[model samples]
Target: MIRTFAFDVGETLVRDDRYWASWADWLHVPRHTVSALVGAVVARGQDNAEALRLIQPGIDPSAAYQAREEAGRGEHLDETDVYEDVRPALSALREAGARVIIAGNQTVKAGALLRALDLPADLIATSGEWGVAKPSPAFFERLVAQADVPADEILYVGDHPQNDILPAQAAGLRTAHVRRGPWGCLWADDPTVIEAADHRIDSLTDLIPLAGQ
Candidate 1:
């Protein structure tokens, strides 16, 4: 039985529209342009940050992120930024005596923002706080340690196939591929994703039944 449900932040629990919009504004580029670039890079199986680099060659995303904060325009998250199904599904799972955790490859600031929303999760963690990012075995190692349970009993859910499904599966955890974000939608039916994911879900609510409550 799945005792713990750990989720990816971007496009899994939270929509990334605001994030991309902030970047577009920071770089003074059209919002659609940045969005398009992100899709383009993801389609090519490249890092999404490649879109930013494509917009402004040689740009340092971290440095640019700090500059955006200094200028009072940085990562922001609120109830509106969350997907409609997030609260209901997470809350339901928790109510059903399942542990719900939010862990993703987000920055420290984004982590803080996520906490401020007060979602019904037992824990909220970010890659920035952990000093490790996904697609790395070390990151999943941290997740397994934090979960404090047999890896097989934990379910790692995310919208990214490469970062979430494959790595988590390789780490011995059951994986759920959520088909919501660009990456999720585009690779939802890919053979690797289909093979790696133990479950394929259309929405967060789909996880409720899998929680075995």
Candidate 2:
């Protein structure tokens, strides 16, 4: 039986389209400004900091400064809409004897979006404040150890193949693909991943049955 549930933050619970809109609004720039920043990072091949310094120029170049500006804006986009259904899914799981936590690549205070969405405090676990990035074995080790649930007893639900499914499965956690959101097209392209997934859901609501309480 699954005793603990962990989730990825960005594009899993946090909506990515809305995240882009907020980034555009905050810097008093066009929507493509956000796109350009991403393109600059991917195309010019620099991390987020170097991209921001090139695109924005005036802002301080610290990691925190760059991340907060982006994260803060994303949270404010669409007035920070919560995943309304996600809450009930989590509540049901918790009621069914699972401890829910989120592990994602994000800045400190990463739970602010979840908090704005009104998720319960304890559900966030040790991730956000601790500043762990994904695909790192050490990050996964620390989170699993903190939850105190054997890897087999935890299910990590996320949307990405690389950042979410592969690493978690390698760590011995059961995996669920959220199946569509930011990563929808990638999922469509690679249906073979279904082979790796223990279960699949279109939305958080479907998780109720999959986790088997």
Candidate 3:
């Protein structure tokens, strides 16, 4: 039985297309440019920070982030910003006696943002808080430690095959690939990648049955 469910944040629980569009606006560039840069980075299997650097070589990321945050103060995720299946799926899991958590690679301020939105989760942990990030054994170790459950009893659902699925599986957690985000869609048709995940889902609600209820 899967006693605990840990989900990746961006593109898993939240959609970030609008945020990137806003970044294009802030940078005074065409929205397509932002999209193209991000696509290029994803094609190369690079991380988000690297994408930002490649898009705007001399830009100051911290300042840009602060500006975005300041301009968007009081702006938090609305129901529409989340995937349609998140709430219902989480509710089903919680009702079924499963512990649900939001675990992802994000800034220190992300916990506050998630709390303000009142997401349905028992715990929320970020790389900033743990001082480690995904694809790293230490990060998954921290999650297992916090969950206080055997690795085999934890199920990690995420979009990234590399950072989320492979690492968690290597760490002994059951893995699920949710095919909605760039990473997920990119590797969706790859036999090796898809076959590695214990479950492949198009919607979060698919997790309900996998969690055994």
Candidate 4:
């Protein structure tokens, strides 16, 4: 009886190849070098922040992110940035009477970017707006309030095992592990993490049938 579906943005609905490339450009390093560094960090179960700092010591993360924002402004998400299955999948869920929303940890400009791209989501929300990030009980509580439903009736779909799957499940929402993004694939083989998700999807299209559409 899932009545609502909340999706994660980055690497779940969209892939930001240029975002990391821009970081490389700012660091004056080869894009592959930076990309590989990020992969290495994730391989060791470290997060992106650790990877960035390891690659460029003394790199001010906020400043680096501001640069990414500047570089990303005019270059909004194009066809390639979005996953091929997102549009059709979201449409199917919406057609099935699901209230589909997108929520994630993103920069303040996320709203603008989402508006510019005009994705299929009925609503888009960010951690910036809520002043809290995922894995915070308050964040999920806010989502429950926003959705106006019991937590058990909501479905949260995201790529991150710890941030999305575990936290959302703990918050009483059925969780879906979308196996596409950095964190998704990184923990794909972990039985503990994988089994925690009520549903597992390699493609967003898989959600269509799962949502009873």
TM-score of each: 0.97, 0.76, 0.91, 0.91
Top of the candidates by TM-score: 1
Query: For candidate 4, lDDT tens digit of each residue in 44-127?
Result: 767777768987789888887776667853335566788889989999999888888898987667766776777787888889
Weakest 10 consecutive residues of candidate 2 by summed lDDT: 72-81
lDDT of 2: 0.68
For model 3, the stretches where C-alpha displacement exceeds 4 angstroms are 70-76
Residue 42's lDDT in candidate 4: 65
lDDT of 4 at 108: 66
Question: Model 3: per-residue lDDT, tens digit, 166-213?
Answer: 999999999999898777798877786677799898999989877752
| Tens digit per residue, CA lDDT, model 2, 154-186 | 888888777678888888889888866636445
lDDT of each: 0.92, 0.68, 0.85, 0.83
Write one digit per residue (lDDT tens) for candidate 1, span 31-125. Answer: 99999999999888899999999999999998998998898897888899899999999999998888988999999988899999999999999
- Shift in Å, residue 55, candidate 4: 2.4
Ranking the candidates on lDDT from highest down gives 1, 3, 4, 2
Better by lDDT, candidate 3 or 2: 3
List, in order, the clash count of every candidate structure: 0, 0, 0, 0
Q: Which stretches of candidate 4 lie over 4 Å from their true place?
A: 67-75
Give the candidate number with the greatest lDDT. Answer: 1
